[model samples]
Target: MKYRIIELSVLIIAVISVYAGLSYARQAAGGQTIQKGGLVADVRAKKIGDIVTILINENARASNNNATQTNKQNQLEATGDFGNSFLNNLSGGVSAQTQNQYRGSGQVSTSGTFTMQITASIIKVKEDGNFIIRGSREVETNGEKVVTVVEGVIRPGDISRDNTISSSKIADARIFHQGTGVSTQAHRPGLFTRILNWIF
Candidate 1:
């Protein structure tokens, strides 16, 4: 009975030691994460309100062409026979004809590209371990002010060690850029053009 008790104790201790070694090995393989910030260099963003740098590179292109044509024609003719009478000179033959034609064509093409960077805040943590982030930026150059805003959802796995994520990895992204001042007005249509467009 004494030997059996001793063997059981030895088995339990060996099992516990093996489990501890495995736990340590796993931690070493994955590296350690410092949960505390401020004094330590913890760059990963894990919670709401944490900021992360976002790199944006997006582009768009579109083109369209259309044409229409229509044509219509109608003709009517009448002839009468008269012998040795003045009516023969005036009513010998009568003819009428009508024709209509229309043709129209149009073409349009547009393309644009945007590349920038902004610091975004984590707004929400999804149930599936995704993050909803929003960011905005404004820049002014020689009395021209441009504002940019971005919002999207990103997976934690896509974030780099420096807490930066590329725009391509983001899903359901909304990006807007607008400018004001002389440069903006220069690109806008003149009053005459606007009036013509409205009338048409």
Candidate 2:
């Protein structure tokens, strides 16, 4: 009976100590005070730009049996809806015509994850009544993915009477070819050169 009494007393003391410690912690936390081991931390966040991706399947067709066929199929397996929104915004309000030029008859897939960093500049008007847009976009796509950037000057005033421009009038054209940790700048056009590109 005496041993039982001693054990009961010890248990009561332990419970009372735990209750006291909990009460003290609650008061300290309410005031955002530092307690025995560590203090509560206040976190801050900053605003920054984002990179996004999207899955796009264009020129889709299905037979009566419902087997799907498409000219291009690109899937983006990234977290968040940022990728979808980015592609939608760039595609211009879900209209078909805006994204048509970028499409091709054969399958041109751009799947996989890519980190895109973009910076753009524009010259509103040229002396020859033409506008110039200079954009620098860095896209890290596939392992062997490469992009050849071209810079050229054109004279709109030199058009012939038939309203057709001559190709020989290209005074200066520079190309910056980049791929696989290798970069080269040359006056000649690279293998992936879209010679005639216009937006009206």
Candidate 3:
């Protein structure tokens, strides 16, 4: 009976020691929370009011051309002779010739390209883990100003570790670019020219 009691006591002591060691280890770990995939959680721009870097490597090109031409020509000739008579001799045979021509041509061409970069901030976060961002940038030099604005939605997964995303990846995007200054004014027609064009 004593031998059995000794075995029971030793088993209880071993279990208690193991439990105490496990509890101490847990406490020593500082109660760190583990992510679903065992990855250390990071504070990324996944919420509203978060600032994100937008690597605006954007480029666009457009071109158009139109041409038209027309040409027309017409000619007519007629000659008449009266029956042999004195009247016919007095009034020489009648002759007539007529000609008409018309020509027209027109052409137009246009093309443009743009590239720029800007940073943006998150304005809202959707239930599906998407972010809505809006931002603008302006550059001025020598009295000339250029403004660029962008607004759109983006998926969190699209953002890189550095919290940057390409403008092309944005969804439902609205982008605008405008310029104003002496250079822009020089490209436009004068007031009188514009008035003439409108009148015509």
Candidate 4:
């Protein structure tokens, strides 16, 4: 009977201790206060692994024209009045004329524009609050695939309130756009042609 009473007392003590600990935690949580106006700032990417949207708006244009023309003419004439008998026959007239002309013209022009949006993950944070980011996106439509890749460093201040940044604002940026499909293949030279060009 005494051993049974001892076991019951120990069990009651354990239950009371658990209840006291729970009560203390609840009181501690309730006593904490939230500061006003502290949550008004927009969420921004500040840590490694955070994601940021990149707006791609790019345009390029180029043109060249070259023209050349050259012309030359030369004439030689000699006349001597030799009243003598044999020298007069040989000195009748001598004339020579030469002319040359050349003309060349060439022109080349190219223009392109790319616009899209992509998300990049911050891979590293610099000591000055800059971010190193890298990301890629691919889309397939009607058996055609287009791929875009971007990597660069960006300052935190450049990020907008919506946690987005323009691709042009990125420093030391590397961007690539590629397409693969039947159309692209048709535009490229054949394998045999390419090999022949390389050999020559």
Candidate 5:
């Protein structure tokens, strides 16, 4: 009986100690404990290892054009010659004209658009309340492989209640998309075309 009493007393003491420690920690952190939901989990990324879903919707376009023109002309004329050389009854006149012109024009235009969705990992947290995130994904279909990489800084307020943020809100963002394989090569220029392009 005495041994049972000792064991029970020890268990009680441990429980009380745990409760006190938890309460103190909660007060220090200014957080509330939800008994039903276990704990009120933060929906926002706060520290390293916390992940934020990134809604990636981006578009890009580029166009270029050039033109050049050149023109030149020259003329010469003379009169009242041979008045003193021959019989004075004959008149001489000379006229000459020269002209040169050049014209050149060129135009080139290109545009592209891309859209994707990716989940990023929070790699760092700054003192200024910024989260540095990096993410990458690769997909292969029909013998063609595509790779995408993204990294950037984000603010906590930009994160939605569902722990998602738009790619547009990311600052200093770097996103790269590339592909390889038969399909990619098919879309690219052939060997002859590439040779011509290199020569030009």
Candidate 6:
């Protein structure tokens, strides 16, 4: 019985020594642990607010023993700017043209009465490349309610293989109104003018 107890004690000590040695070796080899708060560094040339692209690499072998390191890449894009003048004008302000390019994509999803001011322009690009746009705008209004807004996602497969209606056009104007209501002067001519036309 004493021999068995002695053997059990030696086995326990050996296992504990092995565990401590492994832990010490790992620390000496720069085994950095990735915690929940571990954030990758930002390595982008241009950045605006929360919209940023980070270039990063992985080193899982350092913390995970015998694990092959696998690098992962993620692309993130976010925008806060609602469509400005271009959209307002596109719907109907000057020329009238209907194209699905900028139809009902983005939104401002706000629940309040406020005036919005903005500037806008259209851009064309090829199929292959890293392209992104981020903007934000706001107006003075009462924010008594919480609102959640989302822009329509445009995927690569969503585009048409055959390019049609590639260009954009202006919108139209509203009806002619002289005062509070629509002006009926042109439709119903003055009595004097009617008499003059009959006499002529």
lDDT of 4: 0.79
Show where candidate 2 strays beyond 4 Å: 1-122, 128-130, 133-142, 157-168, 181-200
Consecutive 10-residue window with the lowest summed lDDT within model 3: 101-110
Residue-wise C-alpha lDDT for candidate 3, range 116-198, written one tens digit per residue: 66788899888888999998899987777768888999999998776788888999988776667755555455566555445
Q: Model 2: what TM-score? A: 0.21
Q: TM-score order of candidates, best first?
A: 4, 5, 1, 3, 2, 6
List the candidate 4 regions with Cα displacement exceeding 4 Å.
1-41, 61-112, 187-200
Task: Pull out the clashing pairs in model 4.
Answer: none
**Per-residue lDDT of 74-111 in model 2, one digit per residue for the tens?**
33333333455655455333323211123222223243
* Candidate 1: 10-residue stretch with minimal lDDT: 30-39
Against the true structure, candidate 1 has what lDDT?
0.79
Assess candidate 5 and give its lDDT.
0.74
Report backbone clashes per prediction: 0, 1, 0, 0, 0, 3
After superposing candidate 3, which stretches have Cα over 4 Å from the reference? 1-43, 62-115, 187-200
Expressed as tens digits, the lDDT of each residue in 94-192 for candidate 4 is 667766555555544447977889999999998988999998999988777768899999999999988999999999998875667655544455566
Q: What is candidate 1's TM-score against the reference?
A: 0.47
Off by over 4 Å in 1: 1-40, 60-113, 183-200
Error of 3 at 198 (Å): 20
List model 6 lDDT by residue over 80-169, tens digit each.
Answer: 433674545443334333211111111222233332222211122225522222222332334322221111212223222321111011
Give the higher-TM-score candidate: 1 or 6: 1
What are the TM-scores, per candidate, against the unseen true structure? 0.47, 0.21, 0.47, 0.48, 0.47, 0.19
lDDT of 5 by residue, 66-144 (tens): 4444444566766674657553454446656755444444333335656678889999998898999998899987776
